[model samples]
Target: MSLPDDTRYLKGGPVAKRIMAEVARDAAKATAEGFPPKLVSITVGDVEAVGVYVRNQRAKAEQAGIGFEERNFPADLTAAELEAAIHGMNADPRVTGIIIQRPVPRHIPIKAIQAAVHPLKDVEGMHPASIGNIVYNELDLAPCTAAASVELLKETGLDLKGLEVVVVGHSEIVGKPIAFLLMSEGATVTVCHHMTRSVAAHARRADALFVAVGKPRLIKADMVKPGAAVIDIGINTETGPDGKERIVGDVDTDSVKEVASWITPVPGGVGPITVSILLRNTMVALARQRALYQATYGTAE
Candidate 1:
């Protein structure tokens, strides 16, 4: 979708690059200090879409100077076996973080695997404790997408304090964490779900809006407040008149850009920043491990 001339396109390239540079520096330091940050990604079965995501993550990890490993298990692997493997990674001091790729065989419970990853080594921040930390305003290890969305909102240069924010979708990982994260920043956030009687009413009053309901073009221009910053976290595939599949965000970027001051493009927006945040979480986990090491051994190494 073509962006309007007057609207600021919230491209994520610059933000991801700036974060990667810092992570690279710290990654180098962590390596030199005998605590290299290594992320172990577990994938069950052969899923084409998940493969694409795994490759992107590995490339970003390489750019950030972090070690990445992909462990592909058989589709028949049981949940207990997967959890045991995750526990093994948790015990390895060289392993800094663990990421459980989504859509495992229907037999395997994804959340159980996520919980199996140690809280300290849960780089994806899907662990219950990792998500719970956001409630206390400790955002160091928040879910990558939620953290990335908040980071993009900050890039818009809007003062978060008392900002009227409306988040559509209340999923455990994305929507709930986003509301808590924004509230911690002092923004008055209203979350909309399937039960919300008037999603548009709350959305139109928002100074900053976040949408992640997985529905394409769910937020039209009329639903947005003028000059508000819109963060589109939903990634959906839609077939156009040409009979080809295309990616579009939850907000109709082509239409909403005319009214909104800033809007995030689907492919170039939150996805890239989300990957960068994952790498950043890896470093955060490494730092926490390093600090514990220092406290125990009286030396960083």
Candidate 2:
């Protein structure tokens, strides 16, 4: 079967605009009530991509009227030092949300450092508590990337319930969490990894597919099911002859787009939504904290 011409390509800019508008509205409400929303991000290393991502997030936060702060450390910092930084952010009342950028120095135990961040302030939803909440089907923050993937699919007017969904990759940050979230939404979920046998066979059966294996052009046209919704979370780069690197996603966009009914492009797709979802989580955290504060101290006049 050929791809449907009505297939929609999900764009992040409009969704980001909507999120920023909501944040502005909520910030106004918070300010009128005598409180201000804030988000804090902690980075341990000098990874260029991570730095660019943090800057983008800070820009988004500022646009949404939320205070943004970046705490950076040398790449050589020890795990203990990273944990300490997270602990400090956890204790800061003004900081409603905290995200410790990933791929921290190899020496650092990321899980231990993540656990150090207060679960309530873990806006990126990498904390164990957030994962537990997700498993239990409770209303809690999810890793922004995973949540953004689901939201992007939903916004396409597709119903996930009872769909055969295949997720390629098993990283805690994206793959596994997204499969869990999809299962929660009533989709039949399959989780695959690099070692998985007949990966293409699995993908070809998917009514919906999410690829986050971080390999460029990993999913070719033959592996995709016609009319399926494909979400490409992979961002891989290769240096060109001119000594400049170009970014591309796991699926061969030109080819896959011809087979899939709906797809998300690399730079313009999940990335923007991921950052927007971070802002959304921060706003949610702020609203929850504000409600609790008012319940204890009475609403501000």
Candidate 3:
């Protein structure tokens, strides 16, 4: 018989706080060097979801001793204007990271907009160059959300050489990078998406499972291997039996907790860790850009 204490809840609060402290130290060092790091977020419209995300990042930036700036543009702006603005940020050394929020006007091409961001300042890791770097196993600049899942798995101390890992989502931002990053660590990783037939069959045999598709409670108790670690990266809001609103993950926490060795909670799991990694990425941009400057010139300044 399984007990309530059989499973461990993996929370991101502690991990994120530790990372924030380290990022603050790095931010202080960069400030002392007269090149304080800053993150510039580009927002095209006033999407409610994007606003919430921007607020969370702003608070974290202040806590980490990094400066955060937001640039808002009208939806009617021309493509040429957007490209020129991105180019200016790329050339400006004060700008440490550039994040373009989504849900832009349909006239503007999202891919083209993301492409305009310089690879050095692409803190979100959506740039093609940043994504390509992971193929060669160069992980210093990997995607933040994907890196968070990897960081959590590292806590388990599972031998990576032959571990069986199943990822339930194949989205570009979170899933693909995770599969590649896991493979780089020698784990045999299988990626499944909406088109993957019998996804649960693949998930039930893994030493570790990562779920990031937007569906709520898609992975039930039967789909998880006993003692397998579960990482839930999905964030969904819905009405519960009580007729009140609730937030949940892709994994059914109530049922799956009884069987899994470790599981991440919906509201407190990957979100915080991912944000901290974003700040950490911002902190490193100074050193990375300084290296580029040195290679181009004789010094960082």
Whole-model Cα lDDT of every candidate shown, in order: 0.91, 0.84, 0.89
Better of 1 and 3 by lDDT: 1
The alpha-carbon RMSD values of the candidates against the true structure, listed in the order shown, are 1.8, 3.2, 2.2
Compute the lDDT of residue 299 as modeled in candidate 2: 59
Candidate 3 per-residue lDDT, tens place, 1-301, comes to: 2437767878888888888999999999989988798999888865576998899999999888889999999879887899999999999988999988888888889999998999899898889999998888888778899999888888777788889999999999899999999999999999999998999899999899999999999999999999999999999999999999999999998899998998888888888898899998897677889888779987554
Off by over 4 Å in 3: 1-3, 299-301
Clashes of 3: 0
Query: Against the true structure, whose lDDT is highest?
Result: 1
Local accuracy of candidate 1 as per-residue lDDT tens digits, 167-255: 99999999999999999999999999989999999999999999999999999999999999999999999998899999989998888
What is the Cα-based lDDT of residue 192 in candidate 3?
93
- Order the candidate numbers by lDDT, best to worst: 1, 3, 2
Give the best candidate by TM-score.
Answer: 1
Angstrom error at residue 197, model 2: 1.5
Q: Which one wins by TM-score: 1 or 3?
A: 1
**TM per prediction:** 0.96, 0.89, 0.95
